[model samples]
Target: MADMSVAAPRSRGLSLPRVNIRAVVMVLYLGFLLLPIYWLINMSLKTNSEILGTFSLWPQNLTFDNYRTILTDPAWYMGYVNSLIYVVMNTVISLTVALPAAYAFSRYRFMGDKHLFFWLLTNRMAPPAVFALPFFQLYSSIGLFDTHIAVALAHCLFNVPLAVWILEGFMRGVPKEIDETAYIDGYSFGRFFVKIFMPLIASGIGVAAFFNFMFSWVELLLSRTLTSVNAKPIAATMTRTVSASGLDWGVLAAAGVLTIVPGALVIWFVRNYIAKGFALGRV
Candidate 1:
């Protein structure tokens, strides 16, 4: 009787673990997070009249006129080019400066290294507003105002320290013995770093590059403040979409959507490195 009772419940037990509550919760959370993006995309394809005429979970009448306007206008299209230029420039400059600094901090002990590292990071903590006037004055004096380099240099004030901090953490995870062995093999400092050490920490570099790109891409205040006609970023141009005629909500949403594409691509490309960084305790 007891054997029969146990066997009777075995089928019921078999189905209990099949439902993954964790996966369900994650899916719900992802959907919640994605709802705003979906709404924005929905709005971008809709006419201003349609948007105001009804509440919608999706566009009733899909249109591409908003994208057409942005693509055709030189002023509008140049905003994206200018933004991309500065963002790429800033990421390059930040990574170039941070790598050696990070290596020094990670591999060597120097006077007040801790104090210096802390001070560098403190630069990132200060609000950009505090330096906006100073930066404007400096760039104006140097004839870099209204140029892509101006925005890139201004952003460096923040991106450099962040890059250094992240790189330093990743560098510390690499064993010092590798450096010694490379040296013993007659590899010079620069050669060893480029050919060996850099590849060893490739994941860290990917993560750092991803971060630098993301920060510079999204940062508006410095980019907008430093640039004008010659090198105006998309964020600044988006504001001009508003005129005496009122706002172009569809075009604005479309611009916002386009801005997200580059960052998303960067994230997707570096996803493996990000995961590896986490595994190595570098993130």
Candidate 2:
């Protein structure tokens, strides 16, 4: 061969690693999405003077007074407790009502079935502002105003419809043969639904519960309109940060951060169910 083969290329002293375009894009997208949340936390750590006096990325004068005030003050901590109470109530009530309604819609064909489904969705689409006055007056007249139940019931107007819609899609995906099989096996409707059918649609229930909780937790107009001192939600109580001394930026930011924690925890726990719900064409 007379040494005709070319020698391998000599090693370079330095070489830049190839950049992953997708990873870079993902990092940038995450940064963009998280910037506001990061800023809120940053503001929470700073004093009102530091927050207003500077626009630094990190707090120059870090303080925990805002968090301390929220944790120590009954007005603040009770707002969080009130919010949780109503949100849990609404989620339970919505799922309880929607499950049967969804099953009926999925398994049966009846007059006005489709029309009724659409009507339910229309209620979800309707503005809360439209019913604010009515709900306020109704709750007040019935002596239900400023109670946890009032906010829970008010939220059901929207959450129940949404829960029904979502659960109906999931229920429709289940085979009708399962119901027939259960019947043949002597399983009563209630027993079959509770023991067999409910498990099959558990992911749907999780998705519905997550949405219902989030809607009820974050809904301000209805919660605020329906409640005052006794059942004031965190969303309503957050507004109290504004007073004669001007806006309490630090406390407001701290409250917002705390408010996001519950919904974030719910999403974390049900993330798998949410993914499955979407995959099942029910989200």
RMSD of each: 7.7, 9.7
Candidate 2, which segments miss by more than 4 Å at Cα? 1-19, 275-280
lDDT tens digits by residue: candidate 1, 1-283: 1133356444646656755876788999999999999989999999999888899888888999989988999988899999999989998999999999999999999999999999998988989999888999999998999999999888888889888988888899888999999999999999999999999877788788787788888888888788879999998899876663388889889988988888888888887566654443353
How does candidate 2 fare on TM-score? 0.89
Candidates' C-alpha lDDT:
0.86, 0.88
lDDT of 1: 0.86
lDDT accuracy of residue 93 in candidate 2: 90
List candidate 1 segments past 4 Å from native.
1-19, 243-245, 275-283
Error of 1 at 225 (Å): 0.8
> TM-score per candidate, in order?
0.90, 0.89
